[model samples]
Target chain A: MKNYVLNNLPERTEKPRPFGVTMAMDKGLSVREVEDLMSIASGYIDVMKLGWATSYVTPNLEAKLAAYREAGVPTYFGGTLFEAFIIRNQFDDYRRVLDKYKMTYAEVSDGSIELDHDKKCEYIRLLSEQVTVLSEVGSKDAEKIIPPYKWIKLMNDELQAGAWKVIGEAREGGNVGLFRSSGEVREGLVEEILTQVPFEKIIWEAPQKSQQVFFIKLLGANVNLGNIAPHEVIPLETIRLGLRGDTFNHFLNQSK
Target chain B: MKNYVLNNLPERTEKPRPFGVTMAMDKGLSVREVEDLMSIASGYIDVMKLGWATSYVTPNLEAKLAAYREAGVPTYFGGTLFEAFIIRNQFDDYRRVLDKYKMTYAEVSDGSIELDHDKKCEYIRLLSEQVTVLSEVGSKDAEKIIPPYKWIKLMNDELQAGAWKVIGEAREGGNVGLFRSSGEVREGLVEEILTQVPFEKIIWEAPQKSQQVFFIKLLGANVNLGNIAPHEVIPLETIRLGLRGDTFNHFLNQSK
Candidate 1:
């Protein structure tokens, strides 16, 4: 946390940052593991998402939540849990658990289920009244590639419905939505969506190194990226600061 | 650690296991982070590799070594470091450091350096006197694909030279050695290698889940897997035990 990071590295935005945010994906880490990650890379992590359906089965979930809370890191359950609750008609129960954990953020996504777009926005509106909403737009299934115009429209509608950030769903594999099966970014679709959507209001879930490099190169170092693996948090920070080889020259300009 | 795991899960080979050895690749985790990880998952880890050149730059490397030693996990420096030292004529210095660290295991490798097969075997023969050697036999570069016959011969020679285990090099990306660039297993090569080399004497570095599943299915549950990311140790154990969906049927023999 001190001078361990190099001096020539790009200056990163501090906590409560609007742009340079890195959200870690917690895939059922034990409390001790959470303690471990926070001790090392907590400075780089802005938010933590308990990856899809993991929180339900993980042991010591409350203890894990307590550890994150003590570290002042905002913890939210993943959107797959939202879909799980939606299909089971347990929306109120889901809301009650979020309240029980005193969580500050909630992700509303229909990646695995079909919810009418307006109905999803309604849930987002209601949830936004309490916790901050991070509404994800796009499907997890590689078969369902939503049109570029549809992506733009849903993003706009979600933002208007008081969603804090509209997540472009690439899943943990980085092989759906904005990316192809090969994990390559769709140039036309991404370029189109970025033109219509405010970059600040959208978080790209890029879990792969190449995808992270692509986004950082395309949008500069401060671009918000999510679903980052816990151990990769430090590596991702280095990439953001132009300290890693991938972005070593991107932020070196002193004229700025 | 109790019955948190399901009843139908495959019986895991317990501590001091021979076949189901899971070697964790520690790329310079902090002392505190190492302590936290060992506390939670040390029971699952058999050996740990301080990944390529990390021990050189990492702070508290001694403390990190102490933790793995206390946890019953033998720690070894990576192949690249051995290559680095070998190129600089520092094999004695490297051995002295191993003695200083009280490391019972050393990795003799030519992955990053072009050591003659005879010289490599001699390093294995000499180092085997002091510590148990797990010699790796493959090039790290994607361009240089070692033929299947050569793989079997080298692996046999390394084992004959006194490598406790011969590691099939897949690099941490799961894309080299006995695997294709797409991370898919080179099935015929692995089968051919298995015919000539003893299965128990080989540790395959399977860094991806699909590759892990492939080896698990091909070689059965107790396959020795290495270069596993730290967090994935538990998930890999689950895969071995048929706790996950991927290998649920393979390890489960019950009619019900």
Candidate 2:
């Protein structure tokens, strides 16, 4: 297939892609709806996050997971689900459920609740042996702000404990975490963290077009981005390859 | 059976509704995607506009039109499409195809191209005898500024020529039609237009949340709004009924 994306301007590979990974958050999509979305846009998707605790509210879990898996999309529950299990002291039960569903990926985060660094590292270490762990930095609400240095330290610790990637949370609106109320990225904090952690090992959750463009411009076209909305996948891919006006002008300016 | 919309605040009757009509802009969503969206959200949608010349590029028109028809969503090609046909002198063929799809709505617009006031009124008169023509006011692009008085006059003329509703074009972005580039409603234009046109007979295409909130706040909760995206239909209802944060406080303040 002459590469599904038009004109290999920046030429990104298909799945198992090192960068330009688009992670869609399924907040409340039904199995049939998701199947439809994946059938049409699965080529652009790398991972599917069953957004927050929405997966638990749904009637069928196995069927939803199965649909994504059949489409060759890696499926995993949101970190909040993992936190919910941990707070209930059902860590083993969580692992068993994940195994039952054949989910090879897991998300570890202390976004909604609190967890000690030692305990967090221990859980990461425990989960590292069985599945790929995605450790998250930042909180769900503004009441909590993990200092840039502390966030970097935790990212290093989680990676050492065997996290496949550390995600910087921008939530659904891409405003509450890492970004200011206006959705402008905190460039200083970003730079401070990048100095400590490799950019390739972190999936920056950029839910807005401006955020996606910002990250792509700041960290190059192949930056690992996450929390992309379903409809925005193709548009984002076009931006990555300079097919859209925003990035087209961006690359145009860069060449000069 | 329970009302399709929960709580039914500001309670709108399903189709053939006198007030609180929701018009969605198709914007080239695929056949299956539209079906899935309508299955979940069509209760809030009455009219669907295929948005500009997008219908021309969409390959599977019959299947898409059938899906909308099956859902009782009256689908019409946008005024821009009408303007395109009129520009090419293909009104006969356009009407033929619209009848083939059983489309009951015709959008008469001079958004992209120019048609003299008399010629525009003539087209409205021609289409009105056959289809429920929805005439639109304002230019599609920013540079083609129609002064507030001219817009009001044109709106009045179209309605007099028998338009079911005179839509104030906000386009998809909710900018550059009665709105400024900043997406703020031009209050002076709104006031002048409102003085001339009946509010109930107008469908203001308030696509953005801020614009939706503005119209709801200014024109009361039951203002007929159009060009609402599929996902935003429920959210718009929430704002209209004062269920969401933006309008909740406004309604609460008014009650006191």
Candidate 3:
């Protein structure tokens, strides 16, 4: 409504754009909730991921998908679900489940399991043939640290294996994977990875405000951010636009 | 639907009952979002609080309140709004705002501003005549630590001043007022406050999962909890019922 006016706010990328993608993590939000979320923040949101194995326990899964679909937001089952299926030797069933749900995107991740690197890439290739694949690189275990070189190698290999985009894992809490237990970003690792990988193709999993601010300040307004909570979508948009206090001065002096 | 069954779950007090109240914080939720949240978790939510001057800026304020009202959930502006009004010598205008919004509950707090304790009590008494008063008893500043005796005195005074209930301030992030910067509860302060004030008459603002688990375990299933996020309402209900892993073993050995 533009009830109150401000000047020179940072510009954000519109929908169907390659970069500036916002992927929200849905931890069992109801059908109505998804519809409500889409109604308000769909313009800011690029994709929705049903977090972890929540899609397995979440009721009315099809209805939730329909809500997002109607809003023109693509939905995907979380990588944990993929891991759950793979761990149970139900990879074929997982593929069929994707077709059953009419999913346009699929996430291939080894966050929860120890899988052979080639097998992970193979899964990405197979999934990419059927649906757009977003392969995540990083461990969910807080103690397990993957070196910058390894992170770059995996991201490159996954992208080479038909991954439309690679995800930098930070989990939903913004702790572990790209961040320390205290939620501090491993700046060296991130910088090193960016050196070898394209910035636009890596969606950083930043669920915390500080993490979101860090990425926005480091990568400008159009950084691809993932794993946002449903409610924080608008707040994150403001942060991206430098309307929030955290990034208020960030985009102020910069020429657009 | 009881899709999965478990034995020895905790029994929770139903709505229209005192205690066990779950007051969710609506930090500028759209009307559709409110309706969506209520549709799924109305049974778990006892009230909704418009957080910290956000009601002043939130669009569709009346319609959002209507959504909660239609779902049989009462809504109140946050104490910060009350402080904002009082600090500006607009207490009458604040009262008028309550009437204008058809608010059934009002919060009296001085978490942000410095107010004499007697004056704070007077506001509580005055607001009590108009709506149910939920007086908050802590500072928003992390460095400002109110002694246990002061918390006890403030809570007791507010209750005597006709407050329907008292709320412990833990800001939205659960990092101040009754909690340390690390998000750990002030165990001694909370323990002392419980000695003088009945647990049923106090709502602890616990936005973090671990804090929610702490209160649920200490106060049992029917503990009054406030400042919960919209999406966490269902998850909080599960915690109260021992359905979540955090409190899964807490209520296991307890007798209903």
Candidate 4:
């Protein structure tokens, strides 16, 4: 489609570009739905995460993964699924499941289960040897607030343990981890982590539009964002390029 | 596909049944996306509404409509589109657009505009002759709270004026009509309206899960619900059938 209103918009990084990655959440979309989503949004989506333990209940798992693979969008099981395996003493089985599905990426998270920090890093190291690992830092429990320094330390340790990117958990609702119950981002916590961690190596799970806008404004158009809804991919892209009303003025002054 | 757990579930009215209606809101879905949605959710969806004026901006409108038609789901332009025509003195053009798209249903709403009550009923009467009109009876503005008595009167007037079903406007967010800013149902308003207006004749636009649970609890499994997101169709069905956790206990004691 031809550009509708092309003037003073921000430039977006192309696919395979390290920054400006969008990772969409699949909370049980059918195979056809995945195909449709990929047909329209594959360009904007960098990776797809089967949200939580939905892949366990979702029918046609292999077909859904194939659809994403056909679109060249890497797919991975959500971090909670990994935790589910760990809690059940099925870490080796989880690795086999990843191989069976031919998944290129894996998410290691401790949101639902309590695990030693060192143990979490060891799991990350093992998974990284098989496929690219994205370790998630932060708890899904809204009551368990991790200090800013702890977040930075966990992220750095995970990266050192072979995680390609450390994800800041916000859950699918964007109400836990990096955000408050009211969906407000912990600004101080975020800024403190940013002081030690490079923004490009972190995928912030920003499911809400307001959260996405906050990251874009803070980290520019190339900030990596995860947990985007399938339908919101285009809208998120528009927001990143300042074509949407929310950040239209933010990128208006910059030369194209 | 066999249901995972089938016992102790509430009996849902089958497709073509009037009482337990589900109206899904399509903000902007591509043709393929609509096809994918219909494939999995056609049985659950009673009708589909193109939310607000999205039809004006959405690409491939006819193709998208065809996909819904193929699935045997009735499609309609939103009430905001109807009001857009009325304010521009293009009511005739609006009718032509309905015919052009071969729509079987149309929504008549004054949520976005300030149409006089009598004039709104007149439009309802006129459109009812051409298509099955689903007239909405609420304002979009959160500050403009219509009293319970007024809500009852407007609903009755529109139903008498030939509306197939009167819709309680909650917009797409479920936070304006029939609900508070917190997405809480206006219990007093709803109870008072039910005392006069038949619950079967009104489609409650409840986009939130809590609101859906409230209506299902208040009016049983057959209450008409509208403004449900496309992906939520199956989840809503599960809720109505007490297959989901929210309504699981509510229908557990009911006879099969």
Candidate 5:
């Protein structure tokens, strides 16, 4: 099928984008589903995360890895996978297995587990020389909150340690991290975080439509968004390009 | 591959299910994307809605229609399509075109356009005999307010007029209809409507995850949830069966 445009929407840059990057969170999608996603929404997707230890469940990760690699879309195991391996004292074994599978991206996160700052920096420094390492911030549990100032400090430290990008963890649902329970961005926290980090170096995981709208409106259309549900890919693209009513009217209203 | 229990969750009834039905809403999925969805999640889906005039833009709707029918999942246009025809005064032509595409179901709704109670009942009577008709209540736009009394009356009348299920409208967001902006179910409205209608005959359009959890908690695990995003089908099933963290803990807390 030919590339089809939905509306008079701005075209997103092809792969190796600095902004407007879409990272799909794969919460255990079947091989067929992933293939379909790659075929149809590959133009929109920049990276695919095998969300939260899902890669460990599927047998023959090689085939899945190959499919993504062939599509020129890099794939990575979620940070929780790393945490699990680290907890088991099998971080080296995890890296070896990933190398065997020819995986090139690593998501380093301490969302569900603890990693000392020096050890985290060492991991980032080692992985950065070999692959693109996406370091994530914020705790997975709502109760284990990371203050905005601490989050920024950590984000800057990780990036300076050679992390490719710092991800604001929102999990599959948008409420767990920088967002409030109502899916609204905690404006004060967001503003504080942005004050310290380069906006382009951060990927905000805004899964819900409202959050996506909020981020795009506040941070401009080129803001990196992650953890988008598979089906929402096109719709998110439309929003970013001002084809959808929400952002279309929003930008129009702003201009007026 | 044999169907393994999802995350050690219990098995759900397969497709052609009499109860425990999951209907996916397709706002503007391309034919290939639709094919992919059916390929991956067809087992979980029973009905697919070509959400709100999206069928008009999607090319090769017939082939896509045939694909879904072959998958044993009947496809239908959204109620908004029926309203569009009603507004255009081409209801008969709409039915004919639907038949031409071999669509087995039709949605009757007053989401955008206004219809008197008598006219709404008449339309349901006209459609219910010809095809499996799903009638919908509640306005799509926030500015268009629907009274609880009128919604109750129309729901009861539609069922009496032979509609298979009366669906409460929530659009794709699950926020504007029968739900507040927070996606919470309007308890007073729901109570009033339930007084006049059977719960089994009603399919509530709960698109948001929170709203799905709300309905499952309020209406039980057997609640007929509509407008579920294609990707959320399995996750919603887990919520319904008390396998996921939220509902599982809910049940655990209740037992204690």
Candidate 6:
């Protein structure tokens, strides 16, 4: 465990890191799976998002939540769950569920539903008062493209509404937001977003290896990334540290 | 545990299944991780393939192997590792390592190396004399297109040489061998192979959801699948049983 194999790799900002954070997506991992992930790869991850409605369907939700908390990884229900509650007109019930779980982080998103931008920000402000809020900006549908300027405005508004961090939504498939159908990043949109938003405040949901490589190469190893699959946690850390082939020469070339 | 929401789903041929099998790709998973996967999703998995060259990198591999064995899920080193030893004239050392861990299954593949068809079959025959040999056919490179006839010949030859199962070589990425660069299965090639090869003796490497769906729809729910990521075992099972949206209508429509 103390081996120096990662000696030449870039130093990631330490845990409790504002940037260089990884948010792993747990659609519905069993309680034992969470314990196992923590044992093997929690050091590489900062937060866990129970992906799209899994919190609703999964049994032993409390035990799963306790596992993540015991591991010191903050866990949040997926934004789709928030949207589900909002659409059902049961925001109070959702709030009660949050309180019951003692959740410290909550996601506010309008990805799967139609909501006024101002209304979404209002919900963010309300949730931010109770707990740390991470709001997502992007449609879940690949066909519903939000322009770069619109994206920037919404992200800024969400942050101003007191979101701890704004998550740039790319659904778990890694092709819905900030990416083309081919899973290629939209360069111009990304560049525009960078100019308007601080890198430390945006968690780009990169669920694929190529996307992880793209962000690490562009933003250094410290870029905040989200929506990473559980098994990919160690592999993503390897990519970030330049231990993997995709970024093997990244840190070495940086010194030159 | 006995919710049985998949009641209307396709009936999977239960374990000791001749076809409905899921082979998880375990590249360097730690001992605790293997244990965790076994606890959470072992019911969904049948075999564990320690991915290419990872057996060389993982420490406590014996412990990891033992965990899988204790869970009754057979484990095997990837075909690439076999080639690494063969090329180095260290095949005996490799076999000893296999014995050290009491491996019941071992993969023999030439996808990443230049082993003549006859020589590859010889290896299969030799290994099959001791343990169950799973031989993989076709090249790993997407650019290296092996003809349909060649695929049929190699698969037939390997099985004839005593391979328990002839694996159609699509790497864990599912973008090479039997699939296109876009991860689409080559329907014509697959159909041709099916004509020449027996269904029960073939394990298709369908790592992606779409690929799993494709095979399940075409070959029925009991198609043997391999290279499934660890976290995807349950999801893959859900897909097979038509519990997920993608396959929800598949079984229902079939019954009609």
Best by TM-score: 5
TM-score quality measure for candidate 1: 0.63
Per-model lDDT: 0.84, 0.80, 0.86, 0.85, 0.79, 0.84
User: Regarding TM-score, does 3 or 5 come out ahead?
Assistant: 5
Itemize residue pairs with steric clashes in candidate 5. Answer: none
Candidate 5 segments whose C-alpha is farther than 4 A from its true place: A1-11, A181-184, A241-248, A252-256, B1-24, B27-48, B52-66, B69-144, B147-168, B180-256
Model 6 spans > 4 angstroms off: A1-24, A28-49, A52-62, A68-169, A177-179, A182-256, B2-7, B88-96, B141-143, B242-256
Candidate 3 lDDT tens digits, A178-213:
999899998999999899999999999999999999
Clashing residue pairs, backbone N/CA/C < 3 A, model 6: A20-A222
**Looking at model 1, how many pairs of residues clash?**
0
DockQ of each: 0.08, 0.07, 0.08, 0.08, 0.08, 0.08
For model 4, state the Cα shift of residue A131 in Å.
7.6
TM-score of chain A of each: 0.95, 0.93, 0.97, 0.97, 0.93, 0.97
lDDT per residue for candidate 2 within B1-256, as digits (tens), equals: 4457544355445567676788888764767988888888777887898766555435467888888988888888777657545655677877776777677898988776668988888888988888899998887677777788888888888899988889998877787788998899988988888898888888998999999999999987788999898889989988988889999878767766
lDDT of 3 at B145: 83
Residue runs of model 1 more than 4 Å from their true location after superposition:
A1-24, A28-47, A52-62, A71-168, A182-256, B2-11, B52-60, B80-95, B112-126, B141-144, B172-175, B180-185, B208-222, B231-256
Which stretches of candidate 3 lie above 4 Å from their native place? A1-24, A28-49, A52-62, A68-170, A177-179, A184-256, B1-9, B56-60, B84-93, B141-143, B217-222, B231-256
DockQ, model 1, C-alpha based = 0.08
In candidate 6, how many clashes are counted? 1
Query: What is the clash tally of candidate 4?
Result: 1
Per-residue CA lDDT of model 4 for B1-256, tens digit only, reads 4212223445677879778999999999988888778766787789999988899999888889989998999999888899899899999999999999998899888887888899988988998889999999889999998989899999999999999999998988889989999999999899999999988899999999889999998898999999999877766775676544345446655553
Kindly list the per-residue Cα lDDT of model 5 for residues A1-256, writing each as its tens digit: 2222222234456568987789988887766666766765677789999998988888767777777777788999999998999999998898897787777899899998878988988988988877899999998888887888898889999999999899998888888889877687888998898888989999999999988988888877788999998777867776775544356545445544
Residues A1-256, model 1: lDDT tens digits: 5677556666668888887889889875778878888999877888999876566545566788999988889989888767656665778878887887788999999887789999999999999988999999998778998999999999999999999999999988898889999999998998899999988888999999999999988887788999999989999988987878988876776425
Give the winner by lDDT: 2 or 3: 3
